[model samples]
Target: MDAPYGQLIEAEPGVARLLAPNPTPYTFTGTQVHLVGRDELAVIDPGPADAAHIDALVRAIGGRPVAAILVTHTHKDHSPGARPLSATTGAPVVGCAPLVIEGGTEAGFDHLYAPDRVLADGESVVVDSRTLTAVHTPGHTSNHLCFADEAAGILFSGDHVMGWSTSVVIPPDGDMGDYVRSLEKLRGRTQDRIYYPAHGEPVAEPQRLVRGMIGHRLQRERQILRRVEAGDRTVERIVAAAYPGLDPRLVPAAGASVLAHLLELAKRGLVSHADEQWSATA
Candidate 1:
């Protein structure tokens, strides 16, 4: 599965991956577009709207008729190539419901995804032999979805849950409460043993990783509470206190995460948030 455009990981039956050539600080090893099926295929998350990557994707399909275009979310590195690829392969674009920004969206979110068929949670689509059941795990964004292969017990966990870095909780487009709750949602489902993430390598212990993610969020909440109680009012100060030695590049993301936690805490009556600041509910 050697690809000249991007690297290819060893895939199992009915699945192959083509990493997009758009590697950056955000996208660890470039965005991975998964090709699922035997002869005919379903291409998922066709990376950035780059011609080379699209050509690579079409080439990888190797004359196989593409039946479906599945996208997990609408990040710039994830779904921008859907339309062009659709034109090339004539496969209908289908994945998570279109972008619905709640509070606000970050700089890099792809808002142009037009799905031919809107999919909901538990809605399943069969492309060749693979039947991917959409699992609405909205946290990274309002419409993030994770597709599951129920029979094989494998999950295509998008940026909602990744193996490389903890998914950034960018509010108000991203919600910590929803993110934490989604982590809890996956924690109980012990059926999925492996997860194929969009950016990094595949994870074998999805349950353990998900459980750890849940615990990490809760622990982060506690740390944020402690920081707020210790007289850190602003999100920046709280983030500094909560993440003492965080990488400078990730400080902004950490601040957003802390803000999301504070907002969620305010909603739960555990903290008071007002005027661009947060405080302990004394």
Candidate 2:
């Protein structure tokens, strides 16, 4: 936030970030492009395919060799620049499996994302002096990933865990159960001291924040259940009851999250739906 757009500002000894100018209600200030090495860098989350943003990224590179362009997921705001940036720097695009969910384009997914090499869970790519291991976290999207520099105790937590707001789990491709499980996965990583999320500032106390996030999600689940108990059957009614006075622009996303919760509840047999109406199960 302190750093202006398009400038690479160092966060730690070797970690730096460049903020893209694509801010929105969902994207926070912008999509943060993290550079993971001092010399031969691994660019994480190249952001939108804006010509200006790509040029800014190239300028930030400053002729240094880019080992790889790592994308956390194929969200339009997060991965569209990878192709153009890779073409410009000769760096191979990597990380996260390719996914194209129909009817998801309007929801911000970039269906055209094609990684040069898909890094499986726990698979790693070595940069100049850093090794970033891909942690498959399927919540924000089915292919979302968080890169971990274990030696440095730094995690580039993409949309999975951000400081600004809880990730909106759109159903079908996004799962609430998987989102909670992913939060639990991060919570168990005791060694990850700091987290550089795709939005907001760095998380200095990742574990503490992660624990709180887990509790927040659980509380949301309870709220949804309460709404259902109170005769809020459809996702629209549940959202209206659970998130009163929400911004009209964000209502659709909120409805999506509510549906994700209801789907998860249905999976656990705590709720059941018939003809678009949901009810608490025995």
Winner by TM-score: 2
Show pairs that collide, candidate 2.
none
**Residue 273 in model 1: shift from native, Å?**
2.1
In the range 1-282, model 2's lDDT, one tens digit per residue, is 553899999998889999999999999999999998887999999999999999999999999999999999998989999999999999999999888676645457887888899999999999997899999889889899999999999999999999788899997899999999999999999999999999999999999999999999899999999999988889998888888899999998999999999999999999999999999996
Best by lDDT: 2
TM of each candidate vs. truth: 0.95, 0.97
Stretches > 4 Å off in candidate 2: 102-107
- Give residue 129's lDDT in candidate 2 (0 to 100): 76
Candidate 2: residue 75 lDDT (0-100) = 88
C-alpha RMSD of each candidate structure in angstroms: 2.0, 1.3
Count of clashing residue pairs in every prediction = 0, 0
Give me the runs in candidate 1 sitting further than 4 Å from their true place.
1-5, 102-106
- lDDT for each candidate structure: 0.84, 0.92
